[model samples]
Target: MRAFRVLSHAVLAVTALLAAAVPASAKGEDGAPTEAGTTFRTATAVKQGQKATASASAGDYLYWQFPAGAGQRPTATATVNLADVSARHGAATWRLDVFDGLRRRQPCASGEPEKKAGQQDSSVTLTCTLRTVRPWAERWSDDPLPGAYYLRLTVADGPEEDLGLPVRAEVEATAGDAGGAHAGGGELGAPLHAGAVAEPKDGWTGGWWSDRWLWTGGGALLAALAGIGGYTLTRHPHRFRSRPGAG
Candidate 1:
């Protein structure tokens, strides 16, 4: 009976530990905006390298905003997963456009401005990298704008038959050093809709602290300690009866 009780407690502890270690969902972590204005307003709060995923149909506009710190260049990559029904129509072409906070189109230094998914293919990917160009005035003007930048993904040209097919979209962004002192600083653009801002997790930088392995190890250690403590407390206590004549 004692052994059974110990075993039950051990199982419960393990189960609780595993439950606590599960990570939160990656999709919609940053509350991906469905429009341009909302995305521009919330882009500065999104951590670099955090990917956002969402489902949409053809003609639907998906937006992701990111901040390009002063002296930093921003780059974005998007991957689209098409439903099986999408192939029945024909080849589909997608467009990716980069815009500044003011909605002005910005040019990329590399990467295709458009991508196509063949009838036999189920996925397509596109990438864009933007650098700050020095304007003619003052020998240095941040043409790309260091504040908020947006990436707009849409079905520029696709078959009408697959217009309603579902698409799984994922976007990720990063910023690289531009070899100068950081200077640009400004407030985020006003949101066009209510509750457009998303508060990022505290101390989250998409860095070592967010690693899942570290959390898993910590949980395992706590579980082991709980198991040991349970076993010790459940064991029968030592007892002795004093002799009638003994002092």
Candidate 2:
């Protein structure tokens, strides 16, 4: 009986560890590390519900990734160096999002995340604060679902320079869950290829700007021609007069 009791206790401990392994976000000591590091990038000038671009007027973005069914969350801390602030630039804000492959999940509130092992729901943890030296350090966390996940970062408008903002994201996770393996495969949450435009903002593009310029230039040229014709007719009365005065 004692031997059976010992085995049961061991099983319970292992279960408890596994239960806590998956988190919305976790620290380095708690998660797993991959040989292939996980990370992504974006612009600080990114606005809500808008795609990011590497435009001078825009800012910078950074993201982190985790493998599907790894049985752990991906979290990281990075340093952000801000410089060349613009008068129009607003406060530098940091954000986090979870993605199955490339499809981002909606922000989950406390105690309302997807189920993992023993927990009824998962969780998301984030910490953002400012630092001196024009550079800030940010730490992020997320309790990920049993599929591929990504952590995304954004700044309203970043500093000025190539590699303008020094942003680095480190990842950690815990692995091993036979149930997760049966839940689904890695293909479920696949990342989209480059050049995949999810959606555009305000229904405008570079082509639209070019067309506007063409129309404006054409209109100005037509107006100038009309004005010249009117002036000539008014200044030279004989030009339009009947030559012999018979008609």
Question: Which residue runs of candidate 2 sit more than 4 Å off their true CA positions?
Answer: 1-58, 68-90, 106-145, 157-247
What are the RMSD figures for all models against the true structure?
25.8, 21.5
lDDT of 1 by residue, 1-247 (tens): 9999999999999999999898554335356432232244433234467777767777677777665543456788888888795345888898888886567788898887698888888789998988642211131433664345677888888788888788888777777654423223342243212122232222111112323455678889999999987777677333244667989
**Shift of residue 219 alpha carbon in model 1, Å:** 53
Provide the clashing-pair count of each candidate structure: 0, 20
Residue 27, candidate 2: alpha-carbon lDDT: 22
TM-score of each: 0.55, 0.27
lDDT of each: 0.63, 0.34
Model 2 vs. true fold: TM: 0.27
TM-score of 1: 0.55
